[model samples]
Target: MLPNGDIVRQVLLGEKGVCETVSSDALVIDMSTIHPLQTDALIRELQEKGINMMDAPVGRTSVNAIDGTLLILAGGTDEQIARARPILMCMGNELVEAGGPGMGIRVKLINNYMSIALNALSSEAAVLCESLGLNLDVGAIKVMSGTAAGKGHFTTTWPGKVLKGDLSPAFMVDLALKDLRIAVDVARKTGAPLNMGIAAESYYAAASQDGKGRQDWSALLNQVRQQAGL
Candidate 1:
């Protein structure tokens, strides 16, 4: 795997590159995390020259890589994936078929987007907890572990609420907004950098403006989807 799309392009399609060194029969597997559109374009270019290619971006960290237990997200035709499986298995223990051509990188991009952003949000929460004189382990971690705060909305609130089309206000958006404003106010007073919380406040504020304040907090997903015309 290379660092990014530009480097991958340089090594695979540039002067005296893989095209010159490898035969058309060689299957080029790209495990780099790159733009999905770039992955699609590269695959198309490779296929034009009768070269087989697959986007097989791996998941997990370097420790998993060293242990040969990474999760491989493979994007290619079934035949191509079958031919590439043994080679991929050498690097990863699990393989997920992420649809055709460029999907592996697409999934990887989405996963990283959520994870990287959440890292910042998590830091904001940690700092707020510290400023409140709460013990990080006993007060924050232990308390949030069983709730949506730590377990994540996807597995906690979402399934029973908006995902099921309920939106019946198990926790009202207005109440959530009120609580969020309080937290944001506290963070500011404590000199904590809660940028994520500030950004989230705007979304909840928008939801309230859209007359969704009485709806369940999970309905924010629907509000966002509607805003995106999705």
Candidate 2:
């Protein structure tokens, strides 16, 4: 009963399926990543037949699964989730009760959106370095990773540097523009149009041509502020 969302719906609602087969004491847990709305509907359907269920989706590598270290995000009531904890713990090293009903899958979707976007952004950073004929070394990665573009980065930190007019080179304007150019090319090749990314690229290009190429990339924010009369 751990198929995808569509198949789960078909099996549960299909003729003489879970609705008919499940006893009053049965507590069926579904481990599928699906739309919250659909999970809501399924919950209602299951309630009609006195069958309890939980949306408990799992993530991490296949190796993690084999090692019983997957992270499980679950949605259900306190009692229901408590009942499922022993089983969940056996399959995962971490288990989060993401709230009631469809909340688990909803959280997963939001997490997926950020992770997906970050991957592209990360790739863009690498491509930018390549285009600038810069070496993609560990220190470069650390610098980029320290910005808002990666983990352990702080938006406040970058903004602080810019506001204080600290234009020292953690990364330079020409380098930033080069990365954005490669990011744009990557997006185009993947049939993904990057509207804001392209605009940022333009800003960095202008800054570079204005003899700011050697300055910190964050200095481009100053250029933007000047244009806006800020």
Candidate 3:
């Protein structure tokens, strides 16, 4: 319910805060979408005082909240989460135990990162479509909805390719870079800002330069993971 980590900290652990009144056996479930590190720190502080805590940030929209069908990304020990499940179910229908403490917020952060970034990317594409005189509804949305363009790489490309440990070129990285370059060029010429497209071109260009030109476009995930030492 709190806006950010600072407010949550002040209200929970600051001078004359509620932590002083909380019973040791009471479980504190933080439903805020704050920094994962902050969540971990708060949980540790509460645990030191013999107070159990769980992070259960909900997903979906306020509409889902009204319907009690939100997706709850929970993080805690199995026993701790089990004790909180019935209470959580009253709000969210789908409860995913993301991992141990701090993970719920981690997962939520990643989800939001992708979703929020894609929102801007999607807008860029829509503007490009307009600049190209393409019908946004029929020419773009209708076509993209059935393909990886709209359905997303996670469900389409990654599952069959990189996620399976197969990097064989279904759609080669070189070809992807080429296509992206074309789009970026056209967007620039049409006076449409394709900031996301331009940024994506850099990633594809690097993958190609790393001798992954023949690999599947999904291989970028593998390339990134390797770079991260994962």
Candidate 4:
């Protein structure tokens, strides 16, 4: 985030003053991935000068860049996306219009959270498999590949939320906490030990307590990242 913030300062506010020459007709699309709040600040600054901006952060890696098949998660108005679409198409194969300014980064953070968390989960599972002396290739890989956690792509539609960068709740943290608490209670009564469900209850409860009661459940993924020290 520091490096990203430095990029803004150097490019937009530095003595070289690139933004100073921006025409009123210019649409300044910031393709760098940075904090949503920082994007808001940039938007405000550019607005005074009559030059609009879009927060269109690049997705995928350097290899994709070389082939011009990068995915750009853009946050701006429909008009903005339409205006920039042709230019974007030249550099990227996909132009995902996420939402207004800040939305792209929000989506990116949530997507990144899942990626980081899942990688950690997989690494830990791999260690367990190694310690237990299981057949790492077939036993572990094939088993996981067949499970819900691995193959539940269409069954679990997190992309609808994560890609939109919309954290507005279809299921609020408070409601999720209440439901999880009830689930834990039912498990206790039935003598069913829901180990993972119990852990999730703690996460939901903590998120609710943090004033994210009205936020999307994935917003709690930030807490997961923090707890994992990532």
Candidate 5:
């Protein structure tokens, strides 16, 4: 079962439910974008039940999911994951075996930190370009989609969505905050400082509290606008 972990609390529920419902011998692959601690807890619960659990969180867009071109990071026993590789292959073009159990989620946490950081950078760039009357949508598009530094999906879509005030949830603000929280936890675990992550999480938390939790992450621009009294 594909237990999506884009939201912390919901992702936890999904993981737990799947762990409880499935047979002990069943292979449970959790692809949620949630915290590593949550994933670790779920994995432990599954292991106690004799269920094979792997943190196989997905990356890339929904279109990628539909097209079977997602990038998957998998964590589990080398032997267990070897058996599960075919299933992952069906859903993704790249299935990276990221060492033992929980490592997949750990890696995804770091990946999300980078994504949130880049998204913040992208929003600032878009705002700057707009302020400068440069209309650099096309250029930003090229830069964000083309540059290694701008590889995240938010750069591919969020700017225009923000400009048009279309905050519908392809991915929502709450989910983004959940991922940010996950990144914060990872930072704490590694003893790494994350000033930018804290700022971004605060922004997302504000957006969520503003009743835009279910709205698309692009709505963060509106939050910024509202704060600027625009």
Candidate 6:
């Protein structure tokens, strides 16, 4: 809902009572990874108009989205969720009802925060290893095949690109940094001490500042490589 920003509003306004009238017929399940604050307002407004709404933001990746193997975190009423299950089942392998309106977004933010943070740390470590004269090379064949340690987005598809110095956008570094920034804001509000989150955000910040913002999150490794002169 919020992640799409004004886009959702445009849809609702465009359809002429679609947002208002559709509630009288079908359920509205929001899958955007928008701000938690915006989600709450949208849910409340739609619910008041007799709409059956659920915030079910997705996890996993583009590959998962295509494979229907995503992990779904949902927030809405039990009855509404029961109405949503049939739709959700087609899109995800695992679906957990997080809580009410905002929980789905909250969980999504934290999940992204952790993922982006880890990628930053992992890239830093890989670079650190290279700097220490650790044969970080891993042989051209292995690099061509990609490394298992890259994990998640880095899997077979991405690390090879990183190793070969191609920083295309599977998931934009700017977007990852945005999520991390939001997570840091959430942590501050909740009084959570997230030292790694802070550090991860900083690394991404520096990477983005260096003009790799539109590249893949894996581009963080470039910073490591530059520092190691590898």
- Please report the candidate that would top lDDT against the real structure: 1
Better of 1 and 6 by lDDT: 1
Please report how far candidate 6 places residue 190 from its true position, in Å.
36
Supply every candidate's count of residue pairs whose N, Cα or C atoms clash at under 3 angstroms: 0, 1, 0, 0, 3, 2
Residue 75 of model 2 has an lDDT of: 89
Candidate 3, superposed: residue stretches over 4 Å from native:
none
Among all windows of ten consecutive residues in candidate 6, which has the lowest summed lDDT? 139-148
Q: Candidate 1 residues 146-209, lDDT tens each?
A: 7888888989999999999999999999999999999999999999988999999999999999
TM-scores, all candidates, are: 0.95, 0.67, 0.97, 0.67, 0.54, 0.57
lDDT against true structure, model 4: 0.74
Q: Model 2, residue 108: displacement in angstroms?
A: 0.7
Q: Which ten contiguous residues of candidate 2 have the minimum total lDDT?
A: 148-157
Ranking by TM-score: 3, 1, 4, 2, 6, 5
lDDT of 6 by residue, 5-84 (tens): 47765665456646845748667878888887877877777777777667899999989989999998988888877888
Report every candidate's CA lDDT: 0.92, 0.78, 0.91, 0.74, 0.75, 0.75
Instruction: Point to the candidate with the largest TM-score.
Output: 3
Return the TM-score for candidate 3, rounded to 2 decimals: 0.97
Ranking by lDDT: 1, 3, 2, 5, 6, 4
Instruction: Please identify which of the two predictions, 3 or 6, would achieve the higher TM-score against the true structure.
Output: 3
Show model 1 residue runs off by greater than 4 Å.
none
How close to the true structure is residue 138 of candidate 5, measured as C-alpha lDDT? 63
As a whole number from 0 to 100, the lDDT of residue 107 in candidate 2 is 78
Q: Candidate 5, overall lDDT?
A: 0.75
Q: What lDDT would candidate 1 get against the real structure? A: 0.92
Model 6 global lDDT (CA atoms, 0 to 1): 0.75
Which candidate, 3 or 4, has the higher lDDT? 3
Candidate 5 C-alpha lDDT tens digits along 1-230: 33444453353345575544666567777777767887787778667777777778878888998999999999999887888889889999998888888898888888888778777766655654455455676656666667533664455666667666777788889998998798677666655556667888899999999999999887888898899999
Against the correct fold, how does model 4 do in TM-score?
0.67
